[model samples]
Target: MEKYTHLGVYGVLVRDDHILLIQKARGPHKGKWDLPGGSIEFGEEPELTLQREFIEETGLAPITGNIRTAVSYTIIYQYDVNQMEELHHIGIIYDVELLDDQAVLRTDGDGQDSLGAKWIPLETLGLLPLTPFVEMIMEPAVQEESDVGMGTEVEG
Candidate 1:
């Protein structure tokens, strides 16, 4: 039998010349910089889930741009307080743009949901350590925002 897996949705919200990222205040990569996104519901569309997750996690409502890439990444994440170590997920990352920066910020969950969000310079993205898959998908596109298109080359 195959190991159980979890599906996730992520939006890369960029605004005011900065990208919005959530600080992982708990679990796996705690305190890591990454796009604002989360798991998609059973009957939810990936794009719709992205919009909701972005707002819930970052307090920023955004219009998702073309998919930057669909990346498969592995993580042995521990869920629940028991730390039994059974949960695993391959995250899906997407490209997102914020329509406005004048939005409000609110904490999402009680603990470890990484309710903290911030807008950081686009050029500083390379300075932070991220999941290998995220780094791989974002590197080139970060430098060429104007090049992204339905007709442009993208990886899945």
Candidate 2:
């Protein structure tokens, strides 16, 4: 067995009670919902990685991206028929805002990892197969109000 570390930059784009997410086309998270981002290229800045990945995965450009937080998770899986590995995934998350709120999302494969992008309601997050990174960030936000009950939601 072997162990390796993979670091990636991701964005959290939220608007009108919905969150932007990319459907994974491959890798350990294949077919699961993930953040719109990927590994940093050699000699590339983390911010650049976030920007490039967002465009690559969502086909939409972000106007502003600010560092929000970092999170990590570990998974054990078979990388090959004869190889098993422990993968530690470290994610650098950013709070991103789009240039145009109504910009259409890319729903076609990016010829790499993403299948497409979609704006999913926060409340429906639990209904999808999400990557660990998505679960880590969303758990707190979604569960924060669970004990209070939705019927108590105050009208704005």
Candidate 3:
């Protein structure tokens, strides 16, 4: 039987002139840098989902800012083990800022499962091999140009 799953409760965390990224530990994108987030349980709000995800993946309490963008994507996954094919996912990507300035980077496990969380510079982001949509997400915040819908998450 083909399985269709819903993935949510995810966000792109930005902090102190840098963005926080997690190295995937499993699945198709394992070993690649990705925004820290995952599936939202039933009846859970997106913001809550992301906050919970941060603690689970990075061991920090991150605060979300704005809803930068929302897009629905149809992903085709064909599991080689069982030759099963499936499709489905409405990815809700958001912009967020980390409150903990003195936070340290930490890896979850295996240096792949949820391994390594760090704030990398925008310049370096383009150079590194990151997960899908990650590089694009930073484009708005890093650019100097005005009119980039940078909604305020909080006050300093």
Q: lDDT tens digits, residues 25-119, model 1?
A: 76566767666677789899888988887767766665665566676655555555555454456666777765665767554532545647777
Per-residue accuracy of model 3 over 68-105 as CA lDDT, tens digit each: 77654454555677676554655678777767767655
Better of 2 and 3 by TM-score: 2
Q: Which ten residues in a row have the lowest lDDT in candidate 2?
A: 147-156
> Which candidate, 1 or 3, would have the higher TM-score against the true structure?
3
Model 1 residue runs over 4 Å out of place are 1-3, 77-88, 105-112, 142-156
How well is each residue in 16-133 modelled by candidate 2, as lDDT tens digits? Answer: 7789999998877889999999999999999999889988889887556999899998999878889888999999999898988776789886989998899999889999999999
Question: How many clashes show up in model 3?
Answer: 4
Q: Candidate 2: lDDT over CA atoms?
A: 0.88
* Per-model TM-score on C-alpha atoms: 0.69, 0.89, 0.73
Residue 61, model 3: lDDT of: 70
Give me the displacement of residue 112 in model 3, in angstroms.
Answer: 8.9
Q: Estimate every model's Cα lDDT from 0 to 1.
A: 0.66, 0.88, 0.68
Output the lDDT of residue 80, model 2. Answer: 81
Top candidate, metric lDDT: 2
